[model samples]
Target: MSEHKDNAVAETVLVSSSSQPSQKVRQTAPVSAWNVLVQGIALFSDGYNVQIMGYMQTVMAKLYPKQLTSSIKTRLSNSILVGEVIGMLLFGLCIDRFGRRVGIIATTAFLVLGIILSTAAHGNTVTGMFWMMIVSRGVAGVGAGGEYAVCTAQALESADSSASLQKRRGFLVTISTNLAIVSGFVGSSIVSLIVIAAYGNKASEGIWRVCFGIGIFLPLTIFFVRMSLLDSSQYQKHAIQRRVPYMLAIRRYWRPLLGCSLAWFLYDFVVYPFNLLAPTLVSGFTKNPTLLQSVGWSALINSFAIPGAIFGGWLTDRIGRRQTYAVGWAIVCVLGFLIGGLRFPLRHVFPLFVVLYGFFQSFLSVGPGDCNFLVSSESFPTPLRGHFLGFAAAVGKAGSAVGTTVLTIALNSFQNQTKGQQVLFFIGSSISVLGTLVVIFMIPNHPATLEEEDSKFREYLEENGYDTSEMGLVEKH
Candidate 1:
């Protein structure tokens, strides 16, 4: 009799919640194309800075050959990721507590400052230069890290606010984010071309500085634009007026939080190490390739990401998030194993390996890589969106840092370059397989409105007899 009564109560609550007409009504203004463009540009600094480091690694290695040991090089590569982890944690809270605009300006300011410092990093000794750059890049990474959380949350939340955009939210958000990657590639290419033209077959001490200097223009421009931008209506209406205790919010939604964080961690763990070390990997096969050749290969590999991102966006909206991830990860894992295991003659078919690697890297952007941002932003309530997204991104950056560090160590441990590449590929493949399992079993598919998600959470709390009086949670019905 008690069980029957409980079922009846749940049924009653469901019916009552479903019957409310206002629950379906959209409250926020439609997001404009201009908003999306600005948001995408604001995030370009992150992509540009990340890509710049990969190229800079090769240049620094050449210029400071004796001082730039394998261990120090790994640290240099991982520094930005470390900074990003910190930035995401700090700015995630600020964005949720303060406002989206405030977080944007503050984080972008950090990026600009970091870039300026990086460009100016010069020391009397090689050790001083190495540490100075590592510190500067890490500072820039903080800004990039914050942008990953705050900008993504802002863009998605803004898109969700619009009734017209709710259906296409996945595409808009993914494209906007992926544009950063594209811009990073294009920007790095241009910088590399200029450096090559100016200092062909010569070691230019200041060439890397010029590359870092060019990044400042975009972020500085975006910072000013962000200053005048309004906070998203979803955030202002749903979250701005209320304050949810961070710990309590986490306690309530720990499951989704873990899902988002771990999935992102796994995604970054595979992608970042591959991207950061691609030039070095290619250099192993190519005989005496110039800086231009390495940059060209990296750019060629990155070109696939644009189409992959678009396809992933379409797949996310069409097939649901989990399916997209499963398909993409499976493809990447198989390819990774094949690339690692293939014992073909190195010279005749090495280019094939590079192409296959690029193809799998592209697949990553389409699946977990793209959806991690979407799922992280959508899986939580408005009040907790920024915080959760930041936490997840921070975890992901942590994975990137760890992956880069560990993989670098693995590569250095092997005497033969081919053996090192094989080992790294196998490790990446295993990590992708693990990530696929997590996405399938742990993360729930979220395709509903923020209001609907909020209602479900509140209904669950009520059904479980949890008190909501102190949560500042508005009753949807």
Candidate 2:
């Protein structure tokens, strides 16, 4: 009985008599600032866990010389992406099938548990310990992976719920998603610095442990916070929770899925290899630098993305998603080509090389880094949102996995160190050019308002003999 009433209330709060989200409504809606905060910090947690592995490589090497093999480093780095691929597909289907809050709650718990295991990793032998850390981080990766799908849906839905929010949804969602994750990247550096300094710059067994452990706090806080979260109005009204028509959704959105997935693939393929292996890059560029020094440089470089994220957020709203995405990738490609072609000369002025490299990182955050979320999240309707976003993100992570793997193996195999870097620069730049084509040719230009998509989606569904009227959520009492 209460479920039916809740459904009725959802309609009143989220839609007009037109059975579409009402842009004219001026009153408060179901979504609150609290909803936005949880989603943002949740992403921040995801960022920290995934990125901390990069800087932690040095810490691991210092603490365990023989145990930290090239193969081990690569596996440890890509474990999170592997877990994410699994979690994204699993929770992606679950969210659309079961519900959003369920996925959120479960992912947080898994994340917290994974952190605990990784932080407390122990073994009779050092090899066993590294394996423990790898598996544990993978488990946490699952939780973090689940967070991507649910939090994205919730953030956009929160914005879609209210008239005022809808007006600024593009800016709010884009900035929040991009900056929050980048801040995580930055936070990993900050936390590593703090903990390393706390240990008097020693790469003790404690350093890596504390770094991984600290990631648990945010997800732990969010886990409790999400316990009280309700599904959004739009989701309550039109979510296809039962017998989801996968074939029909595919027929309608296959092109977008391919395009969005490819863009993300190209983006992550470049971003992750460079990001996770930053310590190695910096160390190779300079005289033997301490782990502390490499980590500090990485912190500064990651922080440079802040301005790019801010600018991209505003630009996506001002121009358009595809245009902003194309411009950012183009700049990255140009800078990468220049950096690769001039690697020998740039290495002379290490600081100058760092600055130019920072520019490359910054521009990526401007478009592909940030806009990928908007392009995928905003491209689909609420019913299919979680699944498609999951699939795209999973593919993107796969790209990261493949890129990270090939780059690491290639760098390790190269007789000439310079040659290895040239491959990264030239290959990565060329991939960005392809990503630009994917964006231009494949990514559709979404309407100004989400309402337009939802309306069109409903019309399409109803016309196809799907029971649009029976599509709303049936909440628990």
Highest TM-score: give the candidate number: 2
Q: Find the candidate with the highest lDDT and give its number.
A: 2
Candidate 1: worst 10 consecutive residues by lDDT?
Answer: 9-18
Name the runs in model 2 displaced over 4 angstroms.
Answer: 1-33, 474-477
Error of 1 at 229 (Å): 2.1
* Candidate 1 stretches greater than 4 Å from native: 1-31, 240-243, 343-347, 458-477
Question: Per-candidate TM vs. native?
Answer: 0.87, 0.92
- Cα lDDT tens digits, model 2, 205-295, are 8888889889988887767777666667667667776778787788898999999999999998988888876666666666888777889
Clashing pairs in 1: none
- Quote model 2's TM-score: 0.92
Model 1 lDDT per residue over 303-351, tens place:
7677788899898889887788778888889988988888335435877
What overall lDDT, based on C-alpha atoms, would model 1 receive against the true structure?
Answer: 0.75
Q: Model 2 — which ten-residue stretch has the worst lDDT?
A: 11-20
